[model samples]
Target: MPHTKTSDGVRIAYQVRGDGPPLVLLAGQANDHHWWDDVRDDFSDVRSTVTIDYRGTGESDKPHLPYSVERFADDVVAVLDELAVHRADVYGTSMGGRVAQCLAARHTQRVRALVLGCTSPGGQHGIERSGEVRRSLIQSDPEEARQALLKLMYTPAWLAMHPGPYHTLGDRSMPAHARRGHLVASNGHDAWDALPGIVAPTLVLHGTDDLLNPVANAPLMAARIPGARLQLIQGARHAYFEECRDLASPLVLDFLDQKAPLR
Candidate 1:
């Protein structure tokens, strides 16, 4: 429940747990710290993970403005500074992965390694959701919004088996006043221009069936970043971590454990 004050004095909330090499987890867009709870136990054996709620989500302060990925990246920098963690492995999912890539590319000293989950290189992927899906997400009802998001993000079987997490995920949909901003920032995000600059060891995890952010993004990211490795989770979708934590967690841990060639 600890919080850090960003350069602009916004209160950014975060939590640190477990013990090992430090791993910072950036949750997906609209998601909060709890997004990692189901996977943390799997990581505890190999990492000390820190999870945070971005400015407009979870327990963090939801300011009306300054919620772009750049600001969110700065918020992340502030959190690391507050924790006295000069360098740590950084993992991000969805929008969080974009923020993580931004941090590694812009603030190289702060990120030791990078893991991007179910995200994209942004503008390159030809995959675009239909207007109906976008309309359902922007609708008034949180439950409907949540369902629509899950439909795009998770496979049908995964949605059926984990009804509880999907319900909890509903709470993260766009808030009424910030709905427009959220859409603009997310849909407008294009990290392809920046991916080539990330020098940290990189691993891109994508789902073969990811609709919201297509799996095609993985190859684009891996090819651009020197020595980056791309892994595709078959039968998984955009919300693969939430749907297949058991399979995904171990792959992530193993990737982070890989030793970079000696300089």
Candidate 2:
């Protein structure tokens, strides 16, 4: 139930968990801090994980103004500043990864390490979702949208085996306007030129079977960011963090624990 006011006067709601070096968890479009609920505790043993609801989602103030990746990055910094955190490791998934790129590029000193999951640096180079997938995501019906998204998020086998999570996902729905705002912001993000500027030791995690953001983008990101490592989870899809957390968590924890060479 904690909140911070950004420079734009928007209130961003965030939660802190565990104790250790700070690790900020940035969720995908239209998702709140609750998106990290299933995996936040996984890092509690070694990290003080911070999760926040981006403006227009969750408990945060949803201002009726244009939202951009830069704005999202600034919101993150505002939360960090309010928490008295000078610097922290950052992990961003999907659209959050786009914001994370902006954060590392704009506020280099405030980020210790970077983790980009199932995301891409937008613009001409980035691949977008198919028309079918896009249609499903932007559907007016919450249940319809959730079901459509579930298909893109998980492999068919995973979805078949785990019906409970899919149902749980349906129960967590975002407002239509908020979802549209998030999609617009994500669509406008372009960090293709900024990737090379990131100095933080970076890790790009992606699922081989990711339909939303292709796995190919992962290597491109790793190659662009200096000293970045890429880890591709075979047979997994877009929501690997949720569907395959047992495998993804260790790789993330190990990378965060590794010492970054003095720059």
Candidate 3:
């Protein structure tokens, strides 16, 4: 288990797989590196995939204090520093996308390329989940919450067709306190002004029917970031990358393979 200590003395656990150009993966709220497990193998064959447990989740230090997006971004930089990776292709999903936005804005030179999936810039301009979805996300019972999440994340047709995966996702659980901490950090993120500063070539991917973050947010981010391409997965929901990996993986791989024009 490889780990790195952030400047604040919090320890973050991470893992590396396969070989090729570095590709750092950032998971969404309440999830650790494990959230990427389903799609990791696809990228591992062509990229050196890096995944880490954000503070307050997985094996990382979970201090009983408020978490912020900037802090999460710094944690990512610390991990990169420990690994001696000056620059890498960064892929962030949902809350992770918010962290990536902060990282790109504050550490522009450290990101070679960027992928923002099912996320938002956060602010007055950002769209948010509906009350029903929000209630489901914060359910006290882990089992209930998981079921609610599954409903919000996948389309009904996909869920019916892939009953096994749906149940698997429902069985997954996270500590209540850690989930709240992640929510705090996610809610505090605001990168509307910062998006225009990201110089790295970016790809924003979203599912057309994402109930959690809403698909409208994707275009808002792409429009703000220069040279950022927006790709919408039809009929998919929040967890489209996992539910529609066959379609999502190729898009990401192709984007990462493209050479950025000399800046």
lDDT of 2 by residue, 159-234 (tens): 8887754422421456666667887999999898999999999999999988888888898889989889999998
Query: Where's the lowest-lDDT run of ten residues in candidate 1?
Result: 165-174
- TM-score (C-alpha) between model 3 and the true structure: 0.92
Give residue 26's lDDT in candidate 2 (0 to 100): 89
Q: Write the per-residue lDDT of candidate 1 for residues 1-263, one digit (tens) a residue.
A: 79998878778889988888889988776677887777777877767788888776767777788457777788888988998888889889987788888888889888888999877666645346557766877789977876777787778886677666442253345475454555556666777777788889999998898777778778888898889988899989787876778788888888878855211
CA error at residue 118 for candidate 1, angstroms: 0.9
User: Which residue pairs show backbone clashes in model 2?
Assistant: none
Counting clashing residue pairs in each candidate, in order, gives 0, 0, 0
Provide the TM-score for each candidate, comma-separated: 0.89, 0.92, 0.92
How big is the positional error of residue 54 in model 2, measured in Å on the Cα after superposition?
Answer: 0.5
Model 3: per-residue Cα lDDT over 1-263, one tens digit each: 88999888889888999888899998888778888877889999988898888888778888776689899999999998998898998999988899999999999999999999999989898998889888987789978987787887887787788775432242135566776777788988889999999999999999999998989999999999998999999998889899999999999989888865312
